[model samples]
Target: MTVKVTARGAERWKQGHPWIYRSDVAEEPDKTPGIVQAFDRKGKFLGQALYSPKSEIRLRLLSRGNERIDDFWWSDRILVAARRRNGITATAWRVVHAEGDALPSLVIDKYGPFVVAQLLSAGLESVRRDVLEAIKYALEPEGILLRNDSAVRRHEGLASEVVLAHGQVPQVVEIVEDGVKYLAAPWSGQKTGAFLDQRENRNLIGHQTKTGGRALDLFTYHGSFALHLARNAKEVLAVDQSAEALARGAENAKLNGISNIKWMEANAFDLLRELERRREQFDTIVLDPPAFAKTKANLERAVAGYKEINLRAMKILAPGGMLFTSSCSYHVNRDVFNAMLADAARDSGRRIQFVAATGASSDHPELLNVPETGYLKGMLLRAIG
Candidate 1:
């Protein structure tokens, strides 16, 4: 099967864009869903892609040139990705980051001996067996679990299911990050069991805790950030609506033998507003909320939500306080996020200086050409009264 793409699509592909939307195809192929040879409108060979009939993204280009898309190709790609992460000492790290690793629409995160994989695209689903084989041969993980509960799978006409692809996975896997122990239920937990992307950010906060003062960690999932803050703060408040997550965070703190953290189960927005009204203050504040916008359509509303939380957070920070905030929405680029923070600071009447700006951990590498891979954007700021 050959996919004929429009001139615009051809230009985008030539510019290294991996997706060819349905509207971009000059003519759709009549064959079934599987691999197809992608060509320009002039019938020139452009690349090979996985054709997804039901998706808006009709073609997910796998190779840009004459490269073959065979079992060898899959094995080699998986091997290369595994080799790149050999330097990562942490047991829980992203082994393959979707397009960031040139394997678009597939994510693999390692949690100790067990590896959790997400097949988000129809293309990856078509080659599921081959992918599993490649992963087994390359990494030889003790267990391989498929976490296909992503909502995006609906667009691909695939049912969401979680199952053990290989070996057995414990009810909860224990992972150690920077000396902090965490219990992650990857099969049922959040994205890939934990926000492993925040590994480095948590370490940074742990180091910044040289001043033993009060700290507030809003939207603190599993209390990862709060535990780190507890290392330096005399008292740390970890807030999250999920009682389960707060319990797990409390358990992690107990595992580390740290008891300074106070777990609170309350909606972050409501709690922040209440704190602001009470004129409460904290020496450190961490805002690691979920993605406010998953798509461009929700960008405006997401901006407002981010601005609200950040504004309230800044207003509640004491003088010379440290604030670490992050946005995991790909639609919210660094420039837009920074601008939103600026607006929040201005509205809150807080003088702040961005001491550090960063993104995901090294294990989750960001490709310069593919900005979507750089989804996590963070800023460490100092509030000056």
Candidate 2:
């Protein structure tokens, strides 16, 4: 099948974007889900794309220039992505990052001997056998688990499921990050067990933490930040709304043989407000909430939500305390997030200094052309009276 894209779509693709909207096609190929060659309006070859009739993104280009997406191509792609992270010193890391690796709609995160994969698009989902074969041939992992539960698959008309494609996966796979051991309950915890993207951010916060001081970790899923901060802080309070995640965090803390972390179950928004009312102060604080804006329509609410938490957190910060904040919402761009922080700082009447800016770990590489790949943005700030 061959797809003829409109001028706008062709230009976008030529400029390095991967997705071609359904409205951007001059001629649609057979209404089937599989690989298709895309061409410009002038009949020039654009790229080889995965075409899905049901998706709003009619085509997701897999290759640029003269390239074939064959079995060997798939295997080589996975290998290249793996080699890119050769220097990443961790037992768990993202091997394939969908568009970040030019493999659209495919995510593979390695967890020890087990690998968890998510096929988020019909195009990638259609080649599951080949992908699994490639993964096995390239990584030779003990197990491959397909965690295809993302809501985005609905746009591709695919059902969400979790299947062990290669071998059995342990109930909880143990992974080490920055010398801290964590039992990642795959497909059960948030976003492929734990927020591997925050590995570097957590380490930075741990280093910035003041010794023998109190620390607060908001939205401390699985206690990653809390455990890291525990190394420096005398007492750490880890709070999250999910009881299961709190339990997992406790388990992880135990796994690391550390007991200074105090787990609290509460909604982060309400808890932040309550802590403000009680005048609770911490020497260090971390705000890592979930994506507040899943869509553009929710941007306003997301901004408000972000502002509320940052304002509250800033108010409770002790003088000369350190703050680590992050926004995972791609809709909330860097400028908007920074502006919200600025507003929070002004309203809270505190002088803040930017210490460092950080992003996702090396494992989750971001494509410069595709801004969506850089969803996790964070900063380290110091509060002064």
Candidate 3:
């Protein structure tokens, strides 16, 4: 292990920058990938690393302290972070959240007894052995799946592949969040079969779904919102573009022996407008769309999408109805999301009484400096026209 950081990179390290780019290096040739080492500009000790010359993130700073970046430290930190999460007993949750957990560009999602580990950077992928060993020892999950399917892999010059590392993952995973049971299909579904980050948001907004309320859920992927709300609401109308998604929503509803849910496959934008045109109204509306715009460059269009959906939701909202709107785009901050919601409220000619502002589950910790981890944002607002 040998390397040196750029002249002022040590300053960045001091300030808790979770990543070390290739430009940050000043010396030392790293022949092998995933090798942990320490270096400084003037031959002084800086910190240890999980090194990868192929990655833009060259080094995952394992420790700023003098401790080695070995199995003991990795296992300890991973468990410490995992223990902080609230409701991950026998279900899936983000056990290790990459940079937020100080293991840069690596995400470990525990799905039921199995775990899905994603190496989003070449540097972290370099330390596969240590990472896998840590999970095996600390978490002791049944199976470990390497879900390296993120777009970040392309940027790092790595190919996408999914493989079962040690054990086998079930096609279906049953998880209970806030007493709300969910059966997730990991094989042909969205990210590891569930949006675990929205667990807190889903549970929080359930209080608003009173009995006999007509609830409309747009982009209701897998019925997390629509199905859960049906427990209390009179009827739950879930809309999405994919028929497969709608079918799964229906299947999930049946799996829970639930009724009073309408799984509709349609463009949510057009459906919302149609509902407004027909003067149809819902007691509650939820907008949990996919990431419209991934990067900051397309933030304007993403904001437009949010504003449009939110505005339509407000239009069809019954008088004194609640609107639970959310955006998963990290580029769209809370301030911007709030601004978009306010604009939607004004467009609907309704006074927006904001009840609560919420974020992702506690398991997905948000580092103040790393804004990307603080992506999911939601607001519970009631419209009084």
> Candidate 3: TM-score?
0.94
True-structure lDDT of candidate 2: 0.89
lDDT of 3: 0.81
* RMSD in Å for model 3: 1.9
Better of 1 and 2 by lDDT: 2
- Candidate 1 Cα outliers beyond 4 Å, as residue runs: none
Residues 1-385, candidate 2: write the lDDT tens digits: 8889999998888899899999998898668788889888788998889888899998998876677666778899899999989887778899998988889898999999889999998877777888889999888899988888888889899998988898888778888878988888786767887788999898899998999999999999889999999999999999999898899899989998898999999999899899999999999999999999999999999999999999999999999999999999999988899999999999998898888888898788788888989899898999888
lDDT of 3 by residue, 40-109 (tens): 7677787777677776677667776676666777789888888777556536688888878887777888
Decoy 1 TM-score against native:
0.96
Best by lDDT: 2
Give per-residue CA lDDT, model 1, range 120-172, as digits (tens).
98877988888888888777889999999999999999899998999987779
Please list all clashing residue pairs in model 1, or write none if there are none.
Answer: none
Number of residue pairs clashing in candidate 1, backbone atoms closer than 3 angstroms, sequence gap of 3 or more or interchain: 0
lDDT of each: 0.89, 0.89, 0.81
- How many pairs of residues collide in each model? 0, 0, 0
Per-prediction TM-score: 0.96, 0.97, 0.94
